[model samples]
Target chain A: MADELLEVTDLTMRFGGLRAVDALSFVARRGEITAVIGPNGAGKTTVFNCITGFYRPTGGGVLLTHADGARFALQRLPGHRIARRARVARTFQNIRLFAGMTVLENLLVAQHNTLMAATGFGILAVLGLSRYPVAERQAIERAREWLDAIGLTERADDPAGALPYGAQRRLEIARAMCIDPVLLCLDEPAAGLNPRESDELNRLLLRIRADGCSILLIEHDMGVVMRISDHIIVLDHGRKISDGTPEQVRADPHVIAAYLGEGDEDEVPAEEVVA
Target chain B: MKSALRDAVLSALVALRPVPVAIAVAAVFVGRLLLLAWRGRSRAAARHANRAFAERLTQAGKYVAPLLLIVALAVPLSGDRYYLHLGILVMTYVMLGWGLNIVVGLAGLLDLGYVAFYAVGAYSYAIISTTYGLGFWTCLPIAGILAAIWGIMLGFPVLRLRGDYLAIVTLAFGEIIRIVITNWVSLTNGPNGISGIPRPTLFGLKFTPAGGPGSFSDFFHLPPSPTWRAVYLYYVILVLALLTNWVTLRLRRLPLGRAWEALREDEVACRSLGINVTVTKLTAFAIGALFGGFAGAFFATRQAFVSPESFTFIESAIVLSIVVLGGLGSQLGVALAALVMIGGFEVFRALADYRMLVFGAALVLIMVLRPRGLVAGRTPTVALGRKREISAELVAQGRG
Candidate 1:
C-alpha cells in the first residue's frame, strides 16, 4: 500500500436505484501495471471515471500518492483539472479526440492548461515582458518529443477523425502522454485493435511502464491482463469478486466462474497468455 | 469651405498617401513567413511544405487589408457618386462584420439580434442629438455604453443555454428590442422616425453656409453637394474600422478569447478546465454589441435621420452571414466576406429587390459547402506550436 500510486477505498456509485459500482476498492502500485478486467457493464469504466476525475462517485474516496511524495484526492478535481493540473491523463472508451482538430493539435491541446498558465497574463507576454515564451517553448518541445516517441511525426497535420481506428487509439495515448501524467489511466486501449495493433499496444504499455509511470488499465481481454499486468482486479455486477496476481486471479473460483462457465472452471488446461 | 477638408481627406485616403504604412504591415508578415521557411529548410520536407503554406497565407492576409483600404479610399476619390455610396455602405457592413466576429467568431456565441444593438446605437444618438441638441461625438460612447448595458441584460437570461438554444434566445432578444423601439412612438416617433437630425460638424464648421465665409458650395467653388459630407463619414468609419480590428485582435489572444474558443469547442470541457464560461460569453456579447452601437451612432450622425425600419431581422441575418461566409473564427475572413457581401450588394444596386434573395441563398450554399465554415476550425496552430506531421505510412495504415 505504501508503494501504491493510487488507492481506492470502498468506491460506490448509485445511479438512481442501480448500483453501477458497489464499494469496490483496490490499489495501483507505482511503476507497475495494474489491470482491471470484467465482463461488459461490470463497472470497469465507472472505476476509471472515478479515479480520473470524470464522474463523481456517490461514496468513497480516491487517494493518489505520487513517487515525489505529493498526495492528491482525485475526486475533488474536475476532469479538466485532473488532466491538466494533477497530471493525470486518460484515453476514452469511445475515443474523445477533438476530431475537428489536426492530429498534432490534439496533442498540443492536452497541454492547453500549461500554455494558458504561461499566457494568461496575456498582453504582458505579447509585449515581450513576460515568461510566457519560455513556458511556450517548453510545451512545444514536450509535444514534439511525445509525437516522436509515438512515431506519429508523419501524420501531424492530418485530422484526428480521419485516422483509422487503431492509429486514433494510439494518438489518444500520445495526447495523454503530452499531458505528462504521473499515472496513465487507459479505458480499454485494446478495444478495437487488430492482433498486430494489440501487440503494438502491449509493447507501448511495456515502454510506458519502463518510464517509471504507473498504469491502471481496464480491459476485457484476459490474455492482455495475464501477459502484462503485475496486479489484476476482477469485478462482477459492480462488486469486486477477486484481486491478485494474474495466476492467483485465474485460480480464484469466483473469477473462473465469471469468465468461463462456473462448473467448467476445472476443465481448463494450461495455456500461455498471448498479447 | 468646411466640405473642402472632407473631400481632401477622402482623396488622400483614396490615393493611399502613406503607402509605407501598408508596406510596413506587409513586411511584418513577410518576415515571419521567411523566418518560418528558413527554419524548416533543413528540417523535414513536410515541414518546408507546411511552412510555405503558412507563408502564403500570411502574405495573402497582409495584402488583403491594405488593398481593401486602398480600394475603400480610391473608389470614392474618383468622384463617382455611385462608388462613393457603395464604399460607404461597405464600411458600415465592415464595421458590423468586425463586431459580429467578436460575438460569433471569437466567442462562438451566435447572436441574432446584433442589429438590435445597431438600432439601439442609432436611436440613442438620434434622441440625444435632436432633443438635447448634443453633438454626435459625445453620443458615440453613450450609444456604445447603452448597447453594452443592453448586451449584459440579454446575456444574463441566455447565459446558461448552449448551441441552438442560446442562439434562439438571443435572436428573440434582438426582436424584442426592435419591437419596443417601433412601438414607443411619443418619444421615438415610432415608424415615422426622427428627421431633421443634425449632421455632425467638422470642428465649428457645419456643412451649411452659416459659420462659414460663404455658402459651402460658393466657398469651395463647387455645387452644393452632400458628397462632401459623405466622404467625411466614410473616412471616419474607415478609421473606426481599423480601430475595431486592432481591439478585436488584441482581445482574441487574451484569456477571455481562449475561454471563448474553449467554450465553443466543448462547454463541459471548458467548465471542467476552470474557465468561467458565463463571464466569457457575456464579454463577447457586450464587446460585440458595443461595436454595433458605435456603428449605429455613426450612421445616425451621417444620415441625420433614424427609423425603426433600418434595424430588422434581415439586417441581423446579413451580419451573421458575413461572419459565417468569411470563416467561423477568422477575423480577416469576416472582413473580406463583409466587403464582398455588402459591397456586392451595392454593386447590384439596380437589382436591390433581389439582392437579399441572392444573399440568403448564398448563406445556405456556404453552409452546405463547408459545414464548419470557409476556414472551419482552422486556428493559427502556431498558438499551440510546431507539431510533427504524423507519417503518411501510418495514415495508409489508418485507412486499413
Candidate 2:
C-alpha cells in the first residue's frame, strides 16, 4: 500500500434502517486498475459515493494521498470540494454529459475552476485585460488532445447528446480526464457496450492507467473484471467478501458461492474458475 | 386510377362537409402537395441545413450589430416623434430581455422576480435625483450597484432551490417588492410615487428653453423643439442598449459565462466538475440585475416619474417570455424576440379592441410553430472550424 492513492477504512452508509454500505475497506494503488465487483444490490455504488463525497458515511473515513505527499479526508468535504480540492473525478452510471453543450465544451467545462481563476474570477477576462486568452488557448489544446485520444475530434463541434452511446461513454471518460484527476472513479464504464466496444473500453482504460492516474471501476462483467483488473474486490450485502489479486479472488470459495448459488457451492466445476 | 381515387375522396369530403366540391378539391390538392413537399426532405436533413444557415448568421454577428446601430441612429432623422418614442420603448424591452437572458438563458435560473431589479434601479434613480438632486450620470452606476446588491440578496435564499420551486419563490419576491413599494408611503410616496425627477443634461446643458445660457438648443444654435429631447432620449437609450449587448457578448466567452451554461445543463455535473455553483448562480443574478438597473435608471429619467404600478408581475412575465421566445442563450435571438413581440404589439395599437387578441394569437402561433423560438440554436463559445449550433431539441426546456 506504499503507493496507494485512495484508502477506505470501515466505510459505512445507512439509509434509514438499510445499511447500504457496511464496514467496507479497500486500497487503490496509484497507476493501477482496481475493480469492485458484486451481485445486484450489493452496494458497490454506495462505497463509491462515500469515497467521492456524494453521501456522508455513517461511520469510517476515506483518505486520499496525492503524489506530493498531500492528503485529503474526502468524507469531511462537500462533493464539489472533493473533486476540486482532492483532485478526484468520477463518471456517473447514467451518462451526465452536458447535453446542450458541444462535445468539446463538455470537456472544457470540466476544466472550469482552472480557467475561472486565470481570468481573475471573470473580471479581468471579461474586460480583455486578463491572461484568459492564454489560458483558453491551453485549454483548447488539452481538449483537442483528449478528443483525439477518444477518436471524437471530428465531432468536437457537435452537441454531446447527438453522439452515439459508445461515443458518449468515451466522451464522459474524456471529460473526467480533463479534470486532471489523481483518482478516476468510473461507475460501470462498460455497462451498455457490445463486445467490441468493451474491448475498446479496455484499451482506453489501460491507456488512462498508463498515464499514471489510478482507476477505481465498478463493473459487473466478469470477463472484463478478470481480463483487465490488476486487483479485484468483491462485496456481498454491503460487506467486502473477497479481496486479492485476480487469480486469488477468482479462486476464492466465497466469491464462487456468491456468484453461483449460495447453498450449492459444492457443485461448481474446476474449469469454471477461469470464467 | 389516381385521378379516380382523388375525385372520390373530394366527393366524399363534399358529402361530409357543408362545403363546395371545388373548394374541397382545391384544399385536398394543396394539402397533398404540402405533405409531399414536407416528406421530400428528411427532418434530420432540414435541421442540419437550418443549423448551417444559423452558423453563417452568427459568423456575421460582428457586422450585424453595427449595421443595426446605423439604422437606429438614422431613425431620428425621419423626425417622427411617435416612431421615435416607439423605438425607445422597443430598445428598453430589448435591454430588459438581454439582462434576464443572463439569468434564465445562460445560468438556467427561473427568476420571475427580474423586474424587481428593474424597479430598484428606476426607484433608486428617482429617489436620489429628487431628494439629493443628483444628475442622471451620477445615479446610473449607483442605481445599478444597488440593484445588483438586491440581486445578491435575492440569490442567497434561493441558492438551494431549483426548477418550479425556484420560480415560485422568485414570483413571490417580485410581488413582495411591488407590495412593499406601494405601502412605503413616506419614502416612495406610495401609489403616487416620486415625481418632478430631474432630467439628464448634455454636459451640464439642459434641453429646455434658450433663455438658459447653456441649453442644448442654444449650444447647437438651433430653434428649441421638443424633438431635441426626444432625439436625445433615443440616442441615450440606444447607447445604453449597445453597452448591454457588448457586455453580455463579452461575458458569454468568459469563464463565468461557461459556468452558467454548465450549471444550466446539469447542476450535479457542474458541482462534480468542482465549479462553485453558488458563486455561478449569484453572479448570474448580480450581472443580470446590474443591467436591469441601468435600464431602469434610464427609464425613470425618460419618464421623469416613478410609480409602483409600473413595476408589476406582468413586466416580469413579459421579460421572461422575451428570453424564452428569443431562444435561450442567444443574444441576437433575444433582441429579435423583443423587437417582434414588443414592436408587433405597438404596430397593432390602432385596433386597440382587438390588439390583445391578435397579440395572444400570434404568441400562440409562435409557441406552436417555433416552440424553440425564432433562433433556437446557440453558437458554441469556443470551437474549431465553424462553430456549430446546439439545437434547442437538445436542451431541456419549460423548466426555466
Candidate 3:
C-alpha cells in the first residue's frame, strides 16, 4: 500500500521510422497533481494513450501499483480494460460525448458495465428487483451529485451536445467520475477554456485531489502548471527531458532550451547524448 | 394492398379483441397522477422532480396521445382476407425491425446482409423439414442455430471493415446467399420456390384437411375454416414477437449490452474502458441474426413455402427503416415504429399503385416533422424519492 499510483518504464511507440514516444519513464504518486508539459508534438498525449491502453507500446511496461501493492500491467491491458480494471479514466482532446443521447444518459452510460453487475444484467434493475433499486438510486445520486458539482443540474435533461464548451468539459469530468476511476488522466483540459473557466477548473482539480483522487494532466498553460502541479515532467520529441518539481523544471537549462524555445533547431542536448 | 386493408377492417368487424397493452398504459397514467400528488406533498426536492414530470407529461402527450387514439380506432375497423394477410406481413416486419434494431440501432453495427441470416433460418427450416420430414417444432432450434452460425460467419471478415464499406459487403453477402439459393435448385428448388411445405399443426391437427383431430376447425368445431388457420398463424407470430422483446430487453441490460453502446459511441474509448469491441460487436451480430432467423423460419412455415423472392434487399431496408424511425437504441420506440410503418402501409393499400407514392411522401413528411421518428427516445427523468422528480438543489450539491 504505497503512495506510488502509476509507474511507466522505458515506454516507446513507433510509427514507420518515427518514434512517437521513445524510452520514457515516470512515476505518478497517489493523491497529487502530476503535470506532463511539453511543446505541441512532444508525445505527451501519445504517452497518455499508451499508458491508458489506447495504443500498444513497442517497448517497456506500465505498472499501476495501487496502495494495496496490487500491480496492474497497464501495458498488457487493452484500452477499455485499462479503464475498468486499472480504475484509469481519461478525457480526449476532442469531446466525444454520445451525440444522439441526452446529457444525463451519457454519464449514466459511463457507469453502464458496473450497473449491469449490480443489477445482475438489469433484469432486477428494470424489474425494480432486489438491491437493484438501491443501485439505480445510487447511480442517479452519483450522476446528480456530479451534475451539481459541475453546475449542470439545470441542464441535466438536455442533450449533451447542447451544452456550452465549458459545461461540456465539466460534463466529461462528471462522466469520468461516474466510472469511479482510481487515476484520472486529462489531456489538455484547459485548452479552450477562458480565464474564468480555467480558474474554476483549477478549483475543481484541487477539490478532486481533496476528495482522494489522483490526477495526471497534460497542459500547455505554464501558469496553471506552476500554480497547481506538485510534480512536473517535461518531454521533447518523445523523450523525457526533465522530471522534477515545477520550480526545478523552470530552472533547468535543458527545459529552457528544448521546451521554452532556444536556437536548438539543430542542437541536441548533452544530457540526451549522455543518457 | 386494398384487399389487405379490407381484410383487416373485416376482421375487426368480426372480432373485437381486448387490447391488454392499451389498458396497461391507462393504468400507468393513473399511477403517475397518484405519484405526482405524493411528490407535491414531499420535500422541496420532490416538488422539483414533480415539476419536471409535469413538463415532460405535456411534451409526450402531444405525440403519444394522438397515436393511441389512432390505434383505438382500429379496434372497431375489421378486415378482409388480403388486408388481414398484409396485417400479418406487417407483424413479421415488426419482428425483423425489432431484431435489426438490436444490432444496427442499439449496438451500432452496420450489418448489410442481415437478410442472409433470415435466409439461413428459412432454408434451414425448408430443407430440414421438407428434406428430412422434420416437424415445424423440430426445425425451429435448427433454424436458430444455423442463422446464428451464419451471423458469426458474416461477422468475422467485416469485423475489420467499418462504415459504408462494411454496409456494402454485408449487402453483397445477403445478395450472394440469394444468388446461391436461386442457382442451386437441387437444394432450394432454385427460383421455382419450395411448395407443398407443411403448415405447422397445433399439436397434430391438419388445417387443410378440416376433419383432422387437432385442426382449428376440429378444435373449434367450425366448418372448414380457412380464416381459423390464418388467425392461428397470427397468434404464433405474436408469441414470437413477444419473445423477441423479452430477450432483447434482457440482453441490452447486460454487461454485453453496455459494452455495445460503448462501442457505438467511441470504439477507442470503449477499448480504453477495457471492453472487448470485437466480442461485443460479434455477439450483437450473432444474436441479432438469431432473432432474424427465428422470424424467417416462422415466415417460411406460415407461408407453407420458401423462395428467394421473400428474402429481398428491400426487406432489409424496410427493417432498417423501422429501426431508424423508432429512434436508435429505444426498444419501445422501435416496436412502435414497426407498428406504425408496416401498419400504416397496409391500411393505405386501397390506394394501391399510389400507395408507395403516398408512403414515400409520408416518409418525407415524417423526416421533416419528427426527423427523430414518432417515438423519439425519452430518458427516464430522475427526481427525489416518492416525488420522482429531479431536485435542482440536490443536483447542484452533486457537482463537486
lDDT of model 1, residue B164 = 61
Better of 2 and 3 by TM-score: 2
Residue A255 of model 3, lDDT score:
90
lDDT of 1: 0.72
Give the TM-score of each candidate. 0.73, 0.89, 0.79
**Model 2: fnat (fraction of native contacts):** 0.78
* Ranking of models by lDDT: 2, 3, 1
lDDT of each: 0.72, 0.84, 0.73
lDDT of 3 by residue, B1-400 (tens): 1122223222322232234334433555676577668767785886466556545643664587457536433422453556557656766887887788778766777665678888889888988988889888888888988898888898888887776667778879999999999999888999988986768888877777445665668777778757666666776776777678777766664455655665666666555554567777888888898899999898899888889998877667667767766765556667677777788877887976555545554554554344455554434333332222222221110000
Q: Which stretches of candidate 2 lie over 4 Å from their true place?
A: A264-275, B1-67, B209-211, B398-400
TM-score of chain A of 2: 0.95
Instruction: DockQ for candidate 2, please give it.
Output: 0.74
Which scores greater on DockQ, model 1 or model 3?
3
A92-201: candidate 3 lDDT, tens digit per residue: 88876655445676677787666667865444554546475566667778888888788888777776666799888888877887788888898888878999999988
By DockQ rank, best first, the candidates go 2, 3, 1
The list of candidate 1 runs beyond 4 A from truth reads A1-4, A64-77, A120-131, A206-212, A261-275, B1-66, B106-108, B116-160, B179-228, B243-290, B303-309, B330-333, B351-380, B383-400
lDDT score, residue B291, model 1? 94
The lowest-lDDT stretch of 10 consecutive residues in candidate 1 chain A is A266-275
- Give the TM-score, chain B only, in order for the candidates: 0.76, 0.85, 0.76
**Which segments of model 3 are wrong by more than 4 Å?**
A1-3, A119-131, A264-275, B1-79, B131-138, B183-189, B203-206, B209-211, B245-259, B325-400
